[model samples]
Target: MSSTELPESVAAAVDPRVSPVRVAEGETLRSVVLPGLTLAVRSRSATAEGAPPALYVHGLGGSSQNWSALMPLLADRVDGEAVDLPGFGDSPPPDDGDYSVTGHARAVIRLLDAGGRGPVHLFGNSLGGSVATCVAAARPDLVRTLTLVSPALPEIRVQRTAWPTALMAVPGMTGLLGRLSRDWTAEQRTRGILALCYGDPSLVSEEELGHAVREMERRLQLPYFWDAMTRSTRGIVNAYTLGGQHGLWRRAERVLAPTLLVYGGRDQLVAYRMARKASAAFRDSRLLTLPDAGHVAMMEYPREVARACRELIDDYDRS
Candidate 1:
């Protein structure tokens, strides 16, 4: 098997145009205009007032829809909202194309600050996971509980295979990326992308496929797709190399919110072994391992993941 056979855990890569963005009546997604960027946001229940609301953030190449399953479950008590980090989902790319992890974290923090809900229940996966951790640490006042699903923190054993995505962050790749695929079809992009993100490609339903295909087609039609991809790529890559400083370790140590660190033992992008270090970082935390799951456990096992989240919510309520 090619090293790039891409273990089944990564679903974002299956389709370049794929996004988790849709609207159900009464459900609305509003893009808040912020300095340097705009965020594609969807909200379910926003009236918690004094209760701790939930916030969801997706990883590389992911959109708000990725949390569709988990959001509905938590919406009742959590009053959750998920945002597409600029450049990946329906959200537009940054004005300066500055997609560093800190940059992304700032975007998240700004959104949370604007939400006006104090110290939310935070959930982040992969790249978003790293950003979420950073946000919680930097502004503990804004985060009550943190739930990280396979966060992309630095590891002693980084995947050499993941370097290609990082390379796109280089100065030259952004322009070249746009030129390389002028006439490429959306279906082609989606097929190539999905092949990389999903452990079991067959698990992707037809509707999901159509959504991705259309999203990619829509985004690629614009001139900003490459910019979004490259900038966000740079941000994600820079996050993996914090040089023993404010990386995941330090952030975890400073995070005051009760944390729940989760890992998919079968994940390819992020090695499950790092869970140990993660556990050590959080002063208040627990670990859950999904042996058969891939990169995105919530997507693969929504009910099980939901049950875990409910457990946390119950714990928070009691506190």
Candidate 2:
């Protein structure tokens, strides 16, 4: 389908004032309630009638705000929408309390099916990346091209710095950490998160940091915050341990869409070494390596990420 064929609601752009990054100068936010999910969707207002539709999914603990920087850059090329998966962002916890990778993928599929936004350009970072892989694999009909940034694909030897997070899957670890860090302020927790998520924390500006701190504060206030984090962390660990058809790596091999995989040399969570394995797993793929980026390259180097995505879209069109 062409860019000008989108429905008015799908093509409508977001109001910039509500954007956390404010980088999405003309972006707007609207709440979408699908079958069992309620998502906070952000989209740019400048998209022309038929701009190709694209959807962004954030990582485990992240919200739709995570795509604030990248969405606007691609506004002219696609009708971009970033979703706050259930239990994250403004969306409430799932009544069923299933935070497995499959559960997340199901939520995404339900939304896409309901909106009839199949064969879209799908983007995901970290945990969201893993979920996107599942979506593209299970329902190739819904995906046109796939882009992954630091996907939480399995690694035999997980990184040392990521151990704490991976350990959250262990029974009682969540309560233990809560007791251990009870005295820590929100700012301290935010700083620690930035240190782990960003290759060079210094790259983030004061304004951005302030916005992030405030967001962290808001997230902490949610009643299901810790439950969601622990359950999702466990889900990722479970995905990593699977070895057959349900395994993430095996699923990655099933993805039929042309894929773009981005990795950061300084990523403390996902090993940069897995870049080659990922490239080999996806039948048709390209890899982009950023030596200075951490886990969130789309946010750290959005221009570069946006450029690569556009190139992928161009290549998909040509094919």
Candidate 2 error regions (>4 Å): 1-24
TM-score per model over all chains: 0.85, 0.92
Best by lDDT: 2
TM-score of 1: 0.85
Compared with the true structure, what per-residue lDDT tens digits does model 1 show for residues 1-319? 0012112122233255443445654355766777677777777774445546788999887777788777876665688788888777767677777688888889888887775766788999988898898999999999888999999887766766566666788999767765887667888888766665555667889987887787776666555667667777777667666656566678779898888888886677778788898899889988888886677887877777788877877887799
Instruction: For candidate 2, report its TM-score.
Output: 0.92
Runs in model 1 with CA error above 4 Å? 1-21, 24-26, 46-51, 174-184
Query: In candidate 2, what are the lDDT values of residues 7-56, reduced to their tens digit?
Result: 22342122222223222456666667655566666777546677778989
Least lDDT summed over 10 consecutive residues: which range in candidate 1?
1-10
In angstroms, the error of model 1 at 319 is: 2.3
